[model samples]
Target: MVDTTLEGLSAVGDTTTGFDHPGLLYHDRDDYLGGARAFARAAVAAGGPVLVAVPGSNLAALRDALSDLGDAVHYADMAVAGRNPGRIIPGVLLAFAAAHPGRRVSIIGEPVWPGRTAMEYPACGQHEALINAVFAGRDAAILCPYDAALLDQDRIDDVWRTHPWMIGADGRRPSPWFAGAFAAADRFNRPLPPVPSAAATLPYVVIAELSRVRAFTAGQARSAGLTVDQTEDLIVAVNELAENTIRHTPAGGTVSFWTEPGHLVCQVDDAGHLVNPLAGRIPPAVTSEGGRGLLLVNQLCDLVRIHTRPTGTTIRMHMTLTP
Candidate 1:
């Protein structure tokens, strides 16, 4: 088994060829700005491409702080670009890295923030852990920032487990509690909470019933106050997942929908087992024949969570009622 406890490590700036995943535990705005600016500057000095993909407000602050770099540093609003944590790896990080081949890449990716909802936190944690696996041999460093003052203790602890290195006010060190990439991802691949008792559910037996699935999703989205565009997006996402069930599993599956405080949730359960953990996160090539369904769902919905085992697999898609 891979070593869960990462012992004997140096500071964050040790300069390694392999992937470096560091967690920046910043206590306040000033601390956040300082750490972020320093990382960006170091990347520029190293002559590699730099990408700062953080929440909108943080993106604005980094832009102002790094004004002298001009277009040398790329900026993306994580709130919009990475709204669905599942998309951050393929859509944002890897996409930027792919743009500049043969060059080491530096990225400041802040996926977790105070405003992240409980329903979204699991996916965020999983995303952070999976980054280590996705970029294992690549020459890249990703600095993930967590708000120490605003976020809860559980979230802070998760940061320690997901990242191989932790950076605090004092300095950086290897995380004693760091779990290997797959272990951490499996830890976050927990069974989703039960949907409300009132959630609408429908069963599908074959491809012929896909239209019914879309109609059901549309009805639930509209009833939950989703706008026309939002409803259409949810319908498409649900249809894609349901079709996967029909195409892959012999037993078919069930579709369910419900509403939380600020979001509408849709779920599909099938007997198929998804062996590939990175199934939907990586973008396929242009000439590829298949494998774009789940990626499309991740882009269409606000959040996507998957729980798969030998017995079955359950995929849930969340869409905010307001946006």
Candidate 2:
């Protein structure tokens, strides 16, 4: 049976079939601990696996609060493990859920936090919204917390649109602004800004040109102060994207490179369109022969954004340069 504490937060439909996801609006550290502790404790009492994936400071605090539970509760530092919001679903959430089959999983996931850059916020919002569709019909309750005091008003408002229910100091209630899963995903799928005029661009029309693509990527990444390992990873990621274009599309794509604040950005534009919304978000089965290119790219980069339509598709990847 689902814990009453989590179930009670449901103001709409039954949560038994479709998972329960609630946005916890917390103003301070005390408010965050209170709500998160209650939710986790109840799940532990129900004898289900619990995962607490939040930022570093919160992870430390939650670890102390649930110290008695020990290994009963699994903890991950979201700041590192979920640096790329695109990896949270496949690498963090689903991986934990799949570990213990036939059991309900409870998670405290805080993806959006203070200090998140403007470029990263959209991916975080879409990740929160897509959780509904990805975990549909699963036995899990994910409580996402938002720092109302730290995050801006716009982000707090997005919390409502992404989550169906919300928990506040008063109590739990339905979010009137909640937009359904797919609609919310589409809302965040805004087109990426054009590459800067100064960005270096190269076009590859054949698979044989892959070597040149890697060389070009390495030169640009190194020039932007990326470390040796960072340059190699960026090269691999760009190679995978360019190779995909040659293999899938009749016309190959163009690759561009530029630098942002502390990041080196690489973009690939092709005449092909990506139809699968969950393409890189889900891990491929062991028996699968292919489909690991984008997943590998997500793992290698600090941030990734994709814009796809009937006209064409553009994929942008960001790698952080060493200090």
Clashes (candidate 2): 0
lDDT score of residue 39 within candidate 2 = 79
Best by TM-score: 2
Candidate 2, which segments miss by more than 4 Å at Cα?
A: 1-18
* Decoy 2 TM-score against native: 0.93
| TM-score of each prediction | 0.91, 0.93
Q: Model 2, 179-219: lDDT tens per residue?
A: 79877777788799889999999999998999999999988
Q: 1-323 in candidate 1: lDDT tens per residue?
A: 11111231233343346688899888877778777767777777778778999997888899999999878899999999989999999999999999999999989999999998887899999899999999998999999989999999999999999999988865787999887888888887889888778888999989999999988888898889999999998888888888889999999999998877788888999999998888888888899988988889988998999998999999999898774
Per-model C-alpha lDDT, please? 0.86, 0.86
By summed lDDT, the worst window of 10 consecutive residues in model 2 runs over 9-18
Root-mean-square deviation (CA) per prediction: 4.8, 3.1
